[model samples]
Target: MSPDQFHDRMWEILQDINKNEFHAVAAKPPTDKAIANLATSTGIALPKDFLAFSQKTNALCIMAREELWPEAKLFDVGPAWTFHRGLVILGIEAEDLPEWANIQNAYESLVELYELTDVLPLLKIMGDGNHYWGVKQDGTFVEVFDGEATTLECSFIDTYATEIKELIQRQKDMCELITKRNKKQH
Candidate 1:
């Protein structure tokens, strides 16, 4: 799909998830200045498709759990979860953004930590802060696992669309399983 089409598809999926299952936060579109600043700060030429996406939503955070599960109380732990698992697409840093959602910060840190050359970090899968998908300076996509980078044949936009869809589906499946377990218990 074209970049614009991919953006529309992504928004549709995110909206569906937000309306039915979990909460999702999409930041406002970044301005030209913010995009330019990101490029200058990172010293990497941003991809055209990525630029198109940034224009739609500067950042996204989809919460995995909207409320605490009752099962947690059985484990003698506080009724609170320490971390959430979901998807994150880092975008240009804005005033309202959390530091973790800042693309420039993540890109620079990951590149330096991994000794990765000519790659730009973009997406964090499973909210692990370790697995990532990034664009190389050559305009190709790479998957980074535990700081190791592997080039993927698909374009950045296509990879983004596919991965996001898979993650959403996995989350839905897990939720269904939980519901089944709860029903059996009662």
Candidate 2:
């Protein structure tokens, strides 16, 4: 079965088990093992090394000062599959760094690189760690002094099928570019 179908079925099963209250804290896919179990029971092969993304702590701070509190929105930036202001994250493989970097560069370039916003260097988050950055509510890039970094984390929390779909598309796009580049060199 298609992966979406597989996952939808799994959700349905969970819904059935939860008596349709899927939002209960104990019901959603809380851990990788739990998610894998659902996939397995539903006869869906888990995507290899699936990543769960969590938001950076610094970003959480900005989110806390909000007028609405924890009800922030995902940015609608180009290249983003989805946006969440509180704690945005995605899971990608270390082996996929080149493609990830290309996508990152594409995002930075699309934002006009340093002209429109300063792209802080990727940072290793410290303690309960994840990485994030703040755009001042006033439309300015959050400034970073030398040796400073934007934070990020790989903690798995909310998982979206769109992220999986978008990542698949990125590989397709990269391969097509590689083929075109290779043909030119040959």
Candidate 3:
């Protein structure tokens, strides 16, 4: 699916989840200025598809209990750095950088990695903020686990479409389980 299709379908899924299951926060679209600021601060060029995604919805937060995977939570441009921080920390250790150094050094490492790999931190995967769902420079999605980037099986839109569908199915399963228990109780 294209970015627009993904955006529309994601909103539809969120609306259904909001009406049926737990609360899932869908933030407002971000302004161009906001996106520009993020790019400047991070020193990484944001891909067009990702910029479009940000333009459609700034963030999507799933409640801890409501997450499809134990590690599924997405953030928008503003809070995206929260996930990047994890990457920085991971790089400090994974790359075996000495613990005693200027913090700026760590940040520089992250910027360089992003630039060299063409990967941008897009969302936090785990509620605890350890992992991230990063988008590649080519519009494909990747999972950033402990600062290591691995391409996912599909593109960004397909990945999200799959996620939303799974979330809806999980909601249905939970509802059925609840009704079945209630029937037995009565």
Clashes of each: 0, 8, 1
lDDT scores of the candidates, listed in order = 0.70, 0.28, 0.48
Please state the error at residue 63 of candidate 1 in Å: 2.6
Please provide, for model 1 over 1-186, each residue's C-alpha lDDT reduced to its tens digit, 9 standing for 90 to 100. 678876786676554464455566767777778888888777777777667887777778765665522222334432122222467788776767777887887887786787765778888764367778888787778898888889898766566667666656666666666688789999
> Candidate 3: where is the Cα deviation over 4 Å?
1-3, 12-18, 64-118, 138-140, 165-186
Ranking by lDDT: 1, 3, 2
lDDT of 1: 0.70
TM-score of 2: 0.22
TM-score, ranked from best to worst: 1, 3, 2
Please identify which of the two predictions, 1 or 3, would achieve the higher lDDT against the true structure: 1
TM-score of 3: 0.52
lDDT of 1 at 93: 67
Compared with the true structure, what per-residue lDDT tens digits does model 2 show for residues 1-186?
A: 544454344344332222121121111223455345433433333232221211101111111112221231455233322122221222111323333222133224324523433332121111112222322223223323232333323211112223223333443454465477679999
